[model samples]
Target chain A: MITEQHILSAFDRDLESVQAMIMKMGGLVEAALSDAAAALETQDEALAEQVRKGDAAIDALEESVNAECARLIALRGPIAGDLRTVLTVMKIATALERSGDYAKNLAKRALVLGQLAPIPGAAGAIRRLARQVGLLLKDALDAFIARDAGLAEDVRQRDLEVDQMYNALFREFLTFMMEDPRNITACMHLHFIAKNIERVGDHATTIAEQVIYLTTGTLPGGDRPKADLTVEGQ
Target chain B: MITEQHILSAFDRDLESVQAMIMKMGGLVEAALSDAAAALETQDEALAEQVRKGDAAIDALEESVNAECARLIALRGPIAGDLRTVLTVMKIATALERSGDYAKNLAKRALVLGQLAPIPGAAGAIRRLARQVGLLLKDALDAFIARDAGLAEDVRQRDLEVDQMYNALFREFLTFMMEDPRNITACMHLHFIAKNIERVGDHATTIAEQVIYLTTGTLPGGDRPKADLTVEGQ
Candidate 1:
């Protein structure tokens, strides 16, 4: 019986270690999003380069988390809820990795945008959008650690705000391009950057959804409300 | 000893079931891509709607595959190569699901584009790109099923062709927008649709990477060459 207790404790420790790794990965992604936004706002090529380089770390961490999850399952053979938690961790890591990729893509575009004249207010709007997404990501990860379904739902709802901001920026960029053809090139790059940020929000929502599923044993119903009416009339 | 053989056979059967489901899911995604492109080329709204609705089945298959993987792991406790195969199945299903979403997005855009005047040869370009992506997806999945690392590497390399086509399309769309403002909206939508196709190719490459990792037990080293210079520099 003592040996059984020891085995259970070791399993718990393994699960905690996976959670810790996920938090570490989440932190890297958060930094990537923030640094990517800051680099875009300041047009800092070096910082943008840093954001791009940082992605490899996030990708590596995701692989580590995945390997650990598989190892835990194979060794301990966790059942039901414990199994779900490990699977959720793997899913969340993938979402974070993709979010990191989007940030890297944004930073890459920022480096290109640095060469051209900025469209007025574009950088500020992008920074705001990025900030919102970063916060949602943090909240989603917190909800996962705390097992707080309510907070996860809140993060899911907040994604609509990100989408709305993206839509506003989409229209704003279109107006800028229509007003002056010179703004076209810069606006297009900004649009792609904004789209990338919006994708980060979507990934955050995915994490939130996974959290809810982990806690509730069922996914949330109904389609997520999307406000990014960029291509309307679907 | 007889029971051990029975257990091993059951594990093998479970793994085979997951692989079969993945192939079924891949077929749906390939169809989605082709139908989306054909709808865009022919401006068939009905076909576009059908493609949009068809995504639900792909999504359902992904859920089934995930559940099966979790159950197999918990019940059978597959280890080493078997565990990796199951994990790869889940990852591949996810990539396929995202590819389906992109195809659905393209179909939605196709519905919109059907209302407007056709851009000369843009539909053909999109169709060709979609066909290439579809082929890549097929090869990637086949490689996964066959454990053919060489074929997986070929699929990885073919993604570059999709990216190059996307770059060329980007330049073409820019020319169209610069020549006439009337083309801006259509071209923007078309550009997005083409971007979706390119993204499908990326997901295909992701599956190929997973296949290579599954077969060889090591991810391919160095970054996958990206030829999509849409956001160049830094």
Candidate 2:
């Protein structure tokens, strides 16, 4: 004999399992990003290659997460707030999978950049950007788990700092390219890595936005201030 | 007073309304891409600005689609195939919205590239690529509406051609940049535009894949081949 309470507890357990998979995916993405940044700085082809291979795992995790979410919706028939929670998880998984791809891209470029002469201070600058975005992602996931709308909004504001850092790096790379024609190839590659990190910051902000929406039932009103000079609102 | 048959018919009508919004959004995205491509070829700053400002409508449409899908799910409690169809609409909206953003980014770059002397033949090549991707998006939406798995699979294959075109253009831009230091800035910008189109092609492929999934209840077997050089497997 099954009571309503049994079904409710089972749904809770299922949601917890799915949410744990999301956290696991988030952890994998974070490690990939930080590791890719470190590989770029050290020109470690091996580490970079490892990061590239690891992306398949992230991709698999996202697939599992999506399948699980769809199943939960179909089986549980969750309504209102529960439905919003499920949808938000699906959106976050998409963002995380994309960020993982960016990390893989950085690794591929790192392999290429490893063969070339290291640009002075360029990798360090990119690492700083990566670290900042990593913290943004870490905190966004934290906010999601805690359902802390305030902390999520804080993460949203911090993306502007990431954007500013990216701008500074972009100008620096352009200067390097202009100063020495020989640096053009390296600078171009470095510019892309910086841009990738900047986009990752945007994804982190997206996660924060999703968390806020999940908790508050509405997206933030004011436009998240954009300082990414070139790419123009994307 | 409503019978079971009436309730079933109402669900069908609601679904048709939501899908109609998707087609409308698709049409807007296609126009934005083609117009941006044209603006690039002619260096029409005014036209480019129009495209940039027009992205808001696409974004709004996507938001509306999502909201309506959520409402339908909550109110109707759709299950099985109906649930998958609604979810696919949401996914397609996301792809269309992102493609629209890419078009807007192209316009933004076109504004900058206008001040600089045009790179010989680059704009024409990009236009051709955009046109190919535009056709892909059109066909993908058609596949979705008709529930034609074959057409969806066809659209998936066509993206490889877009990737090949991108690789050719990438090499062309690299040669232009290497031949003259003066061309580096213009070439870099052109490269990004080409890259964006390749991504648009990917989004179309995503839509096509979603269609197959919705129709067949399983993802297509094997990985779709990729040929874009430099951005390896992105």
Candidate 3:
């Protein structure tokens, strides 16, 4: 007895709810990235633990987003643009969930680094790097909400700076290790932590691409520029 | 008007082609992992280049699989079990493509490591770890093809072995770097290579989880056992 219009309205409601969930997940990841960076700078073990614990919520939200997306696809049978929108939302959720994992990892390394003697300038450099990636993620999410491909492309371009920052941090960690053998373990942890944060930047860039694709129905041609060829992360 | 049976058969054909692509992608990844290990052991720059170049094909396959899955979801509007099957194939393809990326990363590191003097036994240890993960991927793909959740669960359990192997390699690299300051750069590259390979195992296990979910309609309760908590990958 249901009319086509009723079903169409139902689809719209489902899509709206799912999109809201994506934004919510993005907000949580942004907070986690920034908070984890602050915790590292301050050597706040309690804050780090909280970041680690909060990852579960992000994971749960991702699962819900994915499930809701799948349900929308199967039930509504959206074609063309609506299908692309659902697919984009699912992809964004996956990327955000991974960024959350990396933030949690940075927090884990921060806790370990807290017990060691402060490496000159390491924590501050790491915090700066984290802030850059956090802002990149925030912009990407805003672009998604605004449906602004230009903003998304701008966010994509910004990742080159993040890569340069990560490379500099990598060399500094290497120098610290070479300067003092005692610095080896701490520096190694720091190196991985920086790598993890760089990965968060990579995720942010990927989210931007998703936004571009959703808006334009095509992925940007050619590779996004990379300052370093070092391959790490998904 | 087209018969419902005709639509069903068309869906089957599309799915069959997509699943074949998944297997092909999986095969390429498995070979890439093994070859990358051999290239590292023999310091064969040519083989490493081959692995890197081969990744483009895997990326193409992933794109094709994703597009085909999206098309099926839209045109065929597969519901319930059929929808789940298509979703599973898409997820497995994603895992395989990431596994391919890690293999390519291993090759990149091999090229770097070839420039430096070998760390004692590092090549053999890494090759062994790569082989373990390779075997794990083989089983995961087999599970996908055979619809064998039991096999998938077995693969899941075996990741613990991969984790333990990687942990041992991490410590060995640390010891090597500490023993000789000159060894630091080479060991850092090796540590990341081993970590990348370990991530290949993680992706393989993720493929296994997707297979399990398809067969049983549930993700395994709780976290998969992780040997070490040093977070390093997506």
RMSD of each: 1.2, 2.4, 2.8
Which residue pairs overlap in candidate 2's backbone? none
Question: Which stretches of model 3 miss by more than 4 angstroms?
Answer: A1-5, A229-234, B1-4, B229-234
Model 2 agreement with the true structure over B1-234: per-residue lDDT tens digits: 478778788889999999999999999999999999999999888899999999999999998998898888888888889888988899899899989989998999998888777899999999999999999999999999999999999999899999999888878877777777778778878988998999999999999999999999888885666776675532
The DockQ value obtained for model 3 is 0.45
How do all the candidates rank in terms of DockQ, highest first? 1, 3, 2
Model 1 chain A weakest lDDT span, ten residues long: A225-234
Note the residue pairs that clash in candidate 3.
none
Candidate 2 residue B101 C-alpha distance from true site, Å: 1.0
Candidate 3, residue A197: how far the Cα is off, in Å: 0.9
- List, residue by residue over A186-226, the lDDT tens digit for candidate 2: 88788888888988898899899999888898888856667
Off by over 4 Å in 1: none
Among these predictions, the greatest TM-score belongs to 1
- Per-residue C-alpha lDDT of model 3 across residues A116-208, encoded as one tens digit per residue: 778999889988998899999999989988889999999989999999898888888888888887888888888888888888888889889
Instruction: Write model 1 residue lDDT over B13-73, tens digit each, in one string.
Output: 9999999999999999999999999999988889999999999999899999999999999
Clashing pairs in 1: none
TM-score of chain A for candidate 2? 0.96
**TM-score for candidate 3, residues paired by index:** 0.95
Predicted structure with the largest DockQ when compared to the true one: 1
